[model samples]
Target: MTEGKWDEKFVVFLKKYYWDDILQLANSYPDQRSLEVDFYDLDVFDREIANELLFNPDEVMPSANNALQQIDLPVEKKLIDAKVRFIKIPNKIPNRDLRSKHLLQFVAIEGMIRKATEVRPKVLNAAFQCMRCEHVTMVPQNEIKFVEPVECENETCGRKGPFKILVNQSVFVDAQKLQIQESPENLKGGTQPQSLDVDIEDDLAGLVKPGDRVIINGVLRSHQRTTREGKSPFYDLVLHANSIEYTDLEFDELEITPEEEEEILALSRDPEIYQKVIGSIAPSIYGYEEVKEALSLQLFSGVAKHLPDGSRVRGDIHMLFMGDPGVAKSQLLRYMVKLSPRGVFASGKSASSSGLTAAAVRDDLGDGRWTLEAGALVMADMGIAAVDEMDKMSTEDKSALHEAMEQQTISVAKAGILATLKSRCALLGAANPKYGRFDRYEGIAQQINMPPALISRFDMIFVLLDTPNEDMDSKIAKHILKSHYAGELSEQRKNLPSSTITQEQVDGHMEVIKPVIDPDFLRKYVAYSRRNIFPVMEDDARDHLVKFYMDLRRMGDGKDAPVPVTARQLEALVRLAEASARLRLSNVANMDDAKRTTRIVYSCLRQVGVDPDTGAFDVDVIASGTSKSQRDRIKIVKEIIKSVGEKHPGGKAPLEEVYAEAQNQQIDRQHAEDLIARMRRSGDLIKPDKEHVKVV
Candidate 1:
């Protein structure tokens, strides 16, 4: 078709279908310079024109813009260089599938923004003044290299000479570069995720940051790869964005049919729903019933509360597993990642501080300027992040998680880029004990290599010790053997004929390890509950939680008693109760939910917070790395040293005298010696000589 005909058709189409939209754009001119037109509307108006626009955007875009300019509005001022942007284009392509055939064609691509460059002014039209004749020339710019006029535009005096740029007169627009990668959840095994560069201009430049899932409609353009030798045969693809739509809504990609929704609702109504959910998580792993229960609740997390004062209470739960080497901690974590609709699994040994949080790096598209890159936590926004081997990470690297786990945001202030990115995801971290095995006599905080402050942030901490028990060990061995047998049979069945291995034999072995609820259905169920269910605490439930908290707090009423729990545990109880209600698809948390949460919290506290010596709950064991009894003994040892040192020269007390004095204060001889050694190791007390000690 001729350009005039195409222009005439677009003008008629606009007047017929977009007259009101055009007037609105004109009223908001300069501020809203682009008018978005739906591709469906265009297709409905003229299918041929729509097809032409999809296949030949470069030719159709100019005609469409010219037609838009011809439209006259009642406003006093005319729209200056208004744009007509297409959206909801039917030709959707995956980043990995983009090919040369799709070049110059209008298509839509969906991915997460892995990196973004700062917005800067890019010249669209250059205004150059010819030095010879003092004549001004306006040249359009499109390629990376700047274009200059061959000669002067003035016909009276044409000369090829240097020209000075009139920066003020040049037409420039805000432009940014983005690197978008395919979502990890969508990739098949053994395949690396593919990424594509995108160029967004005007109002779309600063609208998206790293970790944002977006569907962008644009024309795919290719540039030849050039090296120092010359141009290479390969070409790099870049999308010139026309319009972008954010898909960051939770579980937006999980499409639940009406049948599936009904199934989920039906499952929630089952009497043994909690049991089924627990059984579904790592069913092959022998046992850790309470751990699996907590994981189940973590999937259907509590509602995030946004207070009117602008503060936010994170509803996501954080859990830590510190265990022996033979335990299946990493297996449980990997299974959770598979069950989650959106999840990222990162190993601490391989991930740096910036890799787990966010990084500011200089990329090719940034032209030496720093580009902010999203990390595992940010990529797992609104979902789950399973970090395995957390003990292998350096202290400096692990510190990066403190803010992300608490505030649900990653604040980056590197290389002039200061921005807060969302990391509202549940953390499932697994670590090993310092000595490769737990010491039942010591506090959990002392056994784990992590700091107490970080340890206290976890909603629940489970210690999976490899204790010897005949009945339990036998059951675990059987479960492991059955799982391996099932896997072997499945592999054999794939290669052997049905006659060689009957289906019944394979099914018999698989039944031992198969989950009660299908994994895919479970993932959809979790997404549905999170999206639709926001349970409010009932009066009865609230009272129950308050009573439980008070009962624990009352245990520490005496002056010498240890603190049983802190307010953090109370908040965790509330979150767990809410999650319990969500799992049942109930709108209110009742007595049952409260009771269930209390049971789980009590079990966790008994494992990690109870002081071995006193056999009493002391939150300080996890909060301060010292139990009440231990602190008291240390205080007595300090006073004894201070008084005993006065009797000797240079304020140095003999070790035997200090121990004897501590024994007189009701501390045992063995306990007193251990305290002194601990204090010496901590730098609180220094050994002045072979047999004397002095406080620093």
Candidate 2:
């Protein structure tokens, strides 16, 4: 009698036919009639129904008592009608806990799951967020878990970490995973309808169409899928997260409001606010226009602590600013910290590794369990984090942030807690060129406080040279004086007209931009980036590489900040350019962007890259003034090896003996070691023995 509606009848049939024990209702919606019930539990639960019903702690059902009897704790206990006998047993035992290792054991046994695994159903909520400004969000509260840890490349919002989890209902149970189409036909307006990998098995992989949130249990990858035979799979299943469960629901039938619709519309129209906050103070710090531009990008696109719109942050955008003493870098950094919605600016010497990411500290709240304190990056996630005096920090502390900057997530095993935190944020940083001041004509790398591996992750770096000129110094002094004493400089801005867009509006942009990118140009561009652009070899290679990037971008409508060129290489290309372009608030990637990225690359390349002449790239050429002695030592080492054997007419000497010779010249030990490494790499010298040296 109640089965007249086809949808309702289908739901009933599925419940009775597909599942068992269907009476207990899970959470529900407005109309019970519209609800689809699960009767037969699927292989979704981490435990059996019986075990879960018995042991689960969150539920409040009477069956829970019958479900679990008791667990035997490690301490032994016995009772015999008020009479007891004591027995002693040694602590050592044979193979007390011998079990084969499994991935699940790693996650589950380590308390990922508090109960035994079982067949079950799962429901979760998630939101799609823009990585840049955080002005965009799409939350499907009644959906499956679709959030995976990722670095957010939301334009200037260098925020990174665990992104919004998609709701359970947004998943598609019957779509297919599409193939990667490289042809022009597929390339133009290339957006294929989104489908699930498990369903039709032919939809686009690692992609989410507008208003679409996929719920699957593997890491979501962003590129093409292929096999061992060199043949492309119909779909590239780029993994985002693993071990999945799901349910899908349509949005139209849900109780969505027009206000929500309007918010979505408004978000679609707001121009990309990849423009960084200029914090009036930064502009006041004269000279270092290049450094200022770099820092501006850091506010908009570097490793920030948060997204501008207050969304989850993720992904790569590391940056550093090296300058001379009295360069006003710290003052500028302090101002930037306030401009960001969520930001932290701290001195390098004052921070610990734990303070940079996480710390197990005594919480004054009085819970004896030590609590976790998120450092500048973690707390500033989804926003900007300005670090002052970078070189003064400990090497260990600097290393702690390497993963946070690149991975956009912070995993810590501190106190009694094993936790992974989201820390996707932009980073605006400052440092002295060395313990003293910078050297004119030198790249900032000479005095960087961190490691080279860490250095490479930054989208770009800038040198804040304080070259004193008669005109520039006077200007700087006057500006500082004005900022300090002028009553006109109170921290206030002229009231701008009401912004047409709200944070919520920015969070709702799918319906607008979807039509713009239906061709999936972003995907192709990303592929091209990963495939080609980033690892540049030579000048000609850079020329050829840029075309692929330009062509891929030409494929997309210019609505966003030359949005995601899927490839990390493409990101490098775009990032380098955009960091420059952001300086003047231009929406497009202009010459400035190209030059900025190229300069940073050039600076880095100059340090490690080969030069045709003199057989050395010459850190002295780039690392000019920070340390004359260091540069001299690099040259000295080359000269020494070149002079060895040929000048004295003897077999090549041991490196130790070479160092002994260097010591005679009053060379510092650290400087001597560096000289040897560079000499060995340059083919000027070789290790005949582990410690012995020879001319190459």
Candidate 3:
């Protein structure tokens, strides 16, 4: 109960468990604001003492603090109010698993900080002066709201009258509130992560930001909810943080052993590594080898570059798969999400603009202050985001991703809170064709419900048409049949008694539908490659990329022709080549890597950016509404419509006559109708009747 007597006990406690460490700390403090004591050591010293310290932290922590102050230092090194923190409890609980039994008991909790409130000065001990007797009473404020002495402590003057808080004598500490949520990877099935409030003060305040995974040693405490009706029976729990620590390694949530790293490195050295990786992704989906290869490279992305001029070149490759229904596009996206270490999967139909980027929200989590919440892209920073049903997203929501795709940043300027958050994630987006089926004659961009500007941002776009080919169809059918059989066998085995299943039967099923590499191994491999490798473009690779770009541009024939490609494609080739090199675990992209990526890019361009009639690549088809050939056709159609409308009555041209004239001009009747329909959609022409169209 006495000040110096408590200091003596603290000294004895320190001597018992940390005698040697105290000497080292005495030399380190003032420079170091705190000394971390392990709870295990305290528990080892005396179980009852540790229990008392943890269960009654308020009474015991001051002794620990006084012990720190009592340590003797050199003449010039006297420390004042140096903090003593406890960490590394024997049993740590996950944020979602906290129970009522732990209330007021010291516990270690682990989670990611989802939101943090601003640090403000909170009065810990208030000095109140009684108006009647001028008696000053020191009151400890322990509740959520500040408290004052009910009556003057002076025995002679007992009154419930007003008392002014003595500002000069009050003790305050910087305090902040944090909402810590269980990490997503820790959740089971479709369960939503649980969250709990944490109160951090003094040296621990402002120690973490949103998205940082941390472990905190604290006491779980609860307080009754206060409302207009007065204090209610409902209680809310919070962890009063004592000390906090974060993982030292980036993305340490994904644990990989040294042996696994060796296996990944060995696998990369194989000459057939590329093919193996491609085969590993969604192996049961059968076919789409080119698309699978592209997805493989996307997992091991290129090295991001920051030039001296303060501009950045992103190394993340963005890929889009616009295909027919039942082509397994969503399956591929889900596979990639499982493969990447920090992958985030979202559906455009369900995700909002703020849900996909970042939003400034005012909520109780921040105590009514505006808090910046990270979206899927931001949460997937330094990794990959797989967005399925991308075509279904509202245009307003799609606009939010423009800056995030290229610049790798999301800027929020709302609610007087301006901030820029890093996305830095490769996007693997899938969408169904707008018409519910692919049209071979239509440009890939035209089939998707996305703007040209957004379509052009993707580095590679693949169109998966579900054309009936007896040969390929049989292969896909066989693959699907085998996959279904494997699933059926798994379920049947689960239902059967132990004697009914045999290892031979399980082996038979596994052999029929197994990936070239296991999913867990693939994840570890990707993590290893991304964390260690940063490939640079070799001279020969650069030459090949430049030559490829120039050759594609030359295919346009002349300046009047539509541009075959742009600088964006050039960057894409480099990124893909670098990714290829990373896949091989090489530091330099060789000529082979360049050639492979060039072929891949060519395949993608021929699918999405080509003029189907001319059989030539035209970037305008995807970047702009019309290509050169299409533009010329539009001009001819406009002329024919004008001539026919002028020759006819009421500015209307007969549909049959227009088709006949179009056929005479070397255009098929169907092609002519398609163009006319497009023109009508563009408001260039109006159909007065089903049989007649008028020039607008």
Candidate 4:
């Protein structure tokens, strides 16, 4: 008989007799060729029984026969043990819609996640993507094959997978799941939607074909939803992941050198030079030494690393000022934005939600065609994004922001397109208090129009208040007047040299910057932090304070944020004092380095700690309108005050109450007392001829 005919006959016979058994026996077979030997390649299905039973495994449980009881289906190749059901959650397929994806030019795909569902008998499907070689298939179930399930179809080894399981078990928040019966696994924090586009439908929809690098913008969510009878329990899909995040492309961009980083940082370090740059604009943001330091930390770190989100901008910094107008907060933001490499200024109230993360609806010449544009965050990637009037944005805008700020990405679903885009930018935002002034007595949550959960995400929170002072006002007035008039002067006229520096200058420095320790340095620093910083103990908060010092060292060595040894501890030690030393371009982190970082972090942490009696931290310790750290300090103070009066009330709390407030606010003792004194003198509180005081 001919080889093809012989193979065909073998396949027919196998299908008739052992189709189910072959699938069941798939586990036992060394490889497909084990069965392939007998049937050859006459027909694709010549090995159908083996393919399913061996590879697919719809016929058996486990290894056909085991203690776990590899129960095989009836008429299966392997031995049957008992009745067993492989309960799996279904995943979603790649995008099936094109009109919504809105494919365009110069798009770079960064990442992807699964859209969650909250229906019962939930189908756990494709809300996230895991690559399995050239055969990129999305499995709704968590059990997507990690091993290569097939041979390379081409000359190259095509049938390969990630060699790993990419799981993003970050805190998933699914409210819809809560309404239904949910397992402990589904009940993660915040029912939060995932980020990035995991699936695409077509080329036109920005769904570049499988393996075609693409960027998409869409709301990515992880959820649980009930499926119809006879199907899996939960179903998951990448609902646009949604935004203009996907496009057919990749980027191998250039970077600047360390020398350039050193130069820029050195330039910034000099108050004279730094002041010369923004002196005309931000001359009078007085007394926020820590705030200025934090800003400087972010500024140098961001620029020093030649990339955003580095040590300079850890975990995506976000700030909101709840102060009365007239504070130099806006001025500070303006100057910083201008100093940044790529930044855009927008108001919270007027900025559209979509406009902040993405852009659409541009008319193309007379046609009804719409153009897609990157939003402030997307365009600001690798840079900084500044927003003012933050309280004015709608709740929808705020909700949309929650994911972007944390995950460093955004999803969009409007203008007939669903997509996700990169919004990995430093967020420096400002807002006025609901009372139009710093309400030292209220919860920070209530003062601004944003969620506590969102507020908690910021690395540091500083309140900006228009501290009433005659001398400071005079200085601010004179400075503003000088800047206002100086604005029209040309670069030469001002004798300030150049108004702006080009990216080239920055890049030139990045090119030569050598890695003192490389990424391993970060690992060593993180290890030190975990060991020293994570431990909670009783040592006057000093011995346990190695954590803070270690972190400072890490930040210092990081060139952007730099080294180790001190951050793991919580008590006051170094950072605040050394300040920018950790961000120095040195290859190694020294003791002095750790000390510097410790001082700054300590000050910020102390000012924001809680005071139990007062129900908040000693916020008054850190004055407003100058430093961003004070914002967080105020937030802690507000929470402490709100909770304290409710749980344990006195008509008032004493100076020692600052200690309790510091504890509650996670601040240092010194920070709390400073606030007590400041508030008392300012008359923001009523000190009834004694140590005890209350909000005025």
Each prediction's TM-score versus the true structure: 0.78, 0.40, 0.85, 0.39
Could you say which candidate leads in lDDT?
1
Candidate 3 residue lDDT tens string, 1-696: 555665676677677777677667667765567778888777776676678776777777887887777676544565576777898875588876777888888888887788888888999899999999998999898877777678778889888858999889999988999998887767898889999999998878888888777888888999888989998998899888889977422433568888888888889889899888998988878888899999999988878999999999999999999989998999999888877766789998889999999888887865587888989999888778999999999999999989999999999999998999999999999999899998777766677789888888999999888889999999888888888987777778878776476667877887756788898888777777777788877898899899999999888777667789989999899899999998888888899999999999988887788788887888988888588788999899889888988998898999998999998999889989999999999999999889999887
Better of 1 and 4 by TM-score: 1
- Name the lDDT value of residue 514 in candidate 3: 77
Which residue runs does candidate 2 get wrong by more than 4 Å? 1-281, 302-316, 362-367, 440-444, 481-485, 488-571, 576-696
Q: Give the range where candidate 2 is weakest over 10 consecutive residues by summed lDDT.
A: 106-115
- Flag regions of model 4 displaced more than 4 Å: 1-281, 284-287, 302-315, 359-372, 413-418, 477-582, 589-598, 601-696
Give a tens-digit lDDT track for model 2, residues 476-569.
7776665453322222212334434443433343222122322222222222222222221245435644775555445334432222122443
Assess each prediction's global lDDT (C-alpha) against the native.
Answer: 0.90, 0.44, 0.85, 0.44
The lDDT of model 4 is: 0.44
Error of 3 at 377 (Å): 1.6
Model 1: per-residue Cα lDDT over 341-404, one tens digit each: 6688999788999998988887878768677778999888988999998988999889999999
Model 2, 591: alpha-carbon shift in Å? Answer: 7.8
Q: By how many angstroms RMSD does model 4 differ from the true structure?
A: 21.5
* lDDT for residue 591 in candidate 2, whole number 0-100: 51
Model 2, total clashes: 101
